[model samples]
Target chain A: MDNNSKLTNLHMDAIREVGNIGTGNAATALSRLLGRTVDMDVPVAEFVPIYDVAAHYGSPETYVCAVLVRTEEEFSCSLIFMIEEEKAAILADLIIPMDISGMDEETRLQIRDSALSEQGNIILGAFLNALSQITGWVLPTTTPAVARDMLGSIMDLVASMFGVIGESAMLVKTSLHIKGLDDELGGTVIMIPDPGSLEALLSKLGVL
Target chain B: MTQPIHVGMADLVVSKHPATLVTLGLGSCIGLVIYDQASKTAGMVHIMLPDSREAKNLPKPGKFADTAVPLLLEELAKLGVNKSQLRAKMAGGAQMFSMPGKADSAIFGVGSRNVEATTKLLAASGIRLVASDTGGSKGRSVEFSTETMKFIVKTLGTGTKEL
Candidate 1:
């Protein structure tokens, strides 16, 4: 097989394996938080052209939780989770149950912030670690931005942060089900490769 | 004579005399208003999503369409209003979100799904939909006047129009 085709297959396989591991780690973290056996299932995994991947989910006005992680070699992974507002509140309450009595406005706000941040951290950190183990590359992750009420606004933020990538890139999607919540959370991770970085990673993994 | 009552999301207000119940901003969601003209009683529910199946065990059960509509009807019954005489006018179910290629076919459209679910639920409960303004691409702010039994649908750029 040619070098390009070989690299494609390698990247595809890596993403599939990494998605499973990442979701498993997330399940463990959530189980610890909830003090119960939480079931996390990864239903779908696909490696499609970036544009096709973007088109598949449709741009519904939704609430989004987005985080950006950059590896040691400047390889960036963008994790975006879209959900509805009502679901967001339900998830927030589950993560941080408020006593309601003797709770001030500031405390509520703090609780909300911490819950969102912690949720983002656990999911993203596990995902990055899985990617690192699969590709033998370590990445540093930044804090997540949890937007309460709009999907378009969050996409705009992602576009500005990454600027424009020249052509079609690689995108990975995993549909996750959290057992206790009885709801499915969709996770999309997009990796845009700078030309030099792409070649280096491919070579390091012995695909080039 | 009585003053019109305006009810927003996450609220329930009722009046035994002539009044109005109104709610705004229904996007990919459903707004249900039940009013009995004889008793001048009214209730409005603005549900953001279709059902609470995902949050089945959670409290505050009246936040979903499946649960809220029945709760509203029960409240109306308690106020001495016959279910048959209660007239309903619904508005809202805007496709504020679009999947890229499937714009023409709302096969997976959440807004259309919400409207369908609401209609089906109402029919099963034997509530006749007297008038409705639903399934559009634009968001709507609706007002219900109990005195006149009229539904008003208002868009952001357009002025209020009666349905």
Candidate 2:
């Protein structure tokens, strides 16, 4: 993790700029899809422990609707779009193609998960598309999959990527803001780039 | 009420009768539980990787299966539980996600590798692995009861099962 801490405020600011542009595009697509204006916070780039990443939102066992996306081409990085269960269900109610209100609990859960995965594709896809333009790298987005489970379980599945690289993650935190519509309705887009990729990105941005 | 002692990632804890030892979030990490029926004592270690040799930094025993197993067993031995009487029940080491094209052979295969190293080390230490539920695509939370020496595995959606 010592290597991970080498990113100074200047380096973090530079990475945050890239995240801003990428998530900015995602926010635009989300607005278009929801027919409402959505704003995004300035992304905060930092190194974080994989064990406690979920603690930022809540507990490790807290139910989350997560879209796990990883890209190996043009530099390896994994991105996660995660929302708390009830918050994700609220977004699902708005975006899901089916009627969720009249359905029973189990049926509504299925609809919610299906809707959120597509939402992951749209939002995360737009982020990757914009990042491609910025980096001048054709970074093909990975297939997005939704898993409605404990955040720890999802992290466990992907912990090896970090284990083989560094115990710390290059966590890029982006928050969405819907204001009065739903103050807590936004999601977090977390990016954990491998050490090599982090070096490449930082150097490319003249931060190194 | 006796509280469950919580073990964090790359850490371990030991407890006595009526006390519970738990570790949260066993994603690709492992929770190795060792218990002594006579002493009614339990010890749990949360291991993250397979071998200490793989790590370049200062060795944190609990961070690797190779080092954690022996060290934790030593901790139990100092607590008056004979090494010969220790029985192990391990869980976690689940691959929570898969790579795109690398689904067939996931990168590093850390889950099974952790289990492999733990099994090898435990066998060498002369401890029998009584029961385990490991190697899947789900993260598990585990709790060990000193009273019954029962290992409980909890997945996100599937509820809880005894190991």
Candidate 3:
């Protein structure tokens, strides 16, 4: 067997295991938040070139909210939720019901705040904690930024911090469907590796 | 008697009597124009995507930048507006990129791509951009006041500016 094929198989196994654990944790957090039995499917993980990820995802107009959590082990994971704007509004309304009839601007403002910051806090924190426990790393929380309406602008900001992931990086796709919400939120976690980081991790896991 | 013609996403509107053109809630989408000062004729398009390639067989060709700009220009010419005297001003391409660690690196940086495509299309049509306000993290509302050939940009959290 070629060394390249062996390495590919090892990376695929690691991603699948990581995705399975992370998704299980995400479902637990969401179920608690919504106070219902939330059924989340296992995540589908893949390693694709950075440039090709957009075309792979169907290029829907996206609204994203994101933050980074750094574990005590000095490793970091980024948690971002991507939803359509209308869906986001719906989720916000679900989290905090407002009187849509004759609501004043101030009330609307509160709804926006609750929807953006508060929702971001709950969802991202839960996802990160779940990811940490699954990966056996303790990740410290950071303040999240809320972005509405435009997918590209938010992406540019993310790119600046993480730099461009090379073609060999992996993109992990996960979907969460919360009961009673009647809508699904999809997320993507990009695993960026430097030099031998992925190989070393795989070797330690006995997957290489 | 001329009323303002406001263009929203995936829309195009035109008037010949110094009509005001407005586009609201512009985040990463582009608002374009072709105005003939000599004839008091103007056209505006609010394009959401950069290319029509992804929209093959789509009903509204005007929703993509590559197809919309030419269509607007052609429509203006049919109304007797000269292509030579046409001047353009654009706004509303915001960074809109998510923070790193949270977003898929592939799909998040499209605002820059949108701006690049819009600029390229307009330039190919021989429409020079007289003024532009783009590439921030906020949404903007753009208004072209044909009364004075002035473009007004109103950004959320920031005050309005005129160019």
- The reply for model 1, stretches above 4 Å from the true place, is A1-7, A40-55, A67-74, A101-110, A157-163, A181-204, B1-163
Model 1: share of true interface contacts reproduced: 0.00
State candidate 2's DockQ: 0.55
Compared with the true structure, what per-residue lDDT tens digits does model 2 show for residues A1-208? 3355566888878888888988999989888888888889889887667556556557788777788777778867777888887788888778776666887989878777778877888888888888888788888877786776777666664455565555665678898765456346989887777656777887777778
Residues B2-113, candidate 2, lDDT per residue (tens digit)?
A: 7888888777787678888888777778899998999998888988888777566634568788888888988898889987888999997776665556554545377888
lDDT by residue for model 3 (B1-163), tens: 2556657446788777658898765666677777988888888887666666743254555567888888899889888988889998888667563455634333444566677888998888889788888877786777886677778887644688987
Q: What TM-scores does chain A show, candidate by candidate in order?
A: 0.69, 0.88, 0.72
Angstrom error of the Cα, residue B129, model 1: value is: 47
DockQ of 1: 0.02
Ranking by lDDT: 2, 3, 1
- For A1-208, candidate 1 gives per-residue lDDT tens digits of 1113435666656545556676666667655765656554452343333222323455423444443333434564455544445554455567776564378867865676567557656766776776677677767765554444334323322321221222134344554445545665334433433323555655555655
Global lDDT of each model?
A: 0.56, 0.78, 0.60
Q: Higher-DockQ candidate among 1 and 3?
A: 3
Worst lDDT run of 10 residues, candidate 2 chain B, spans: B99-108
What fnat does each of the candidate structures reach? Answer: 0.00, 0.52, 0.10
Query: Considering just chain B, what TM-score does every model have?
Result: 0.85, 0.93, 0.91
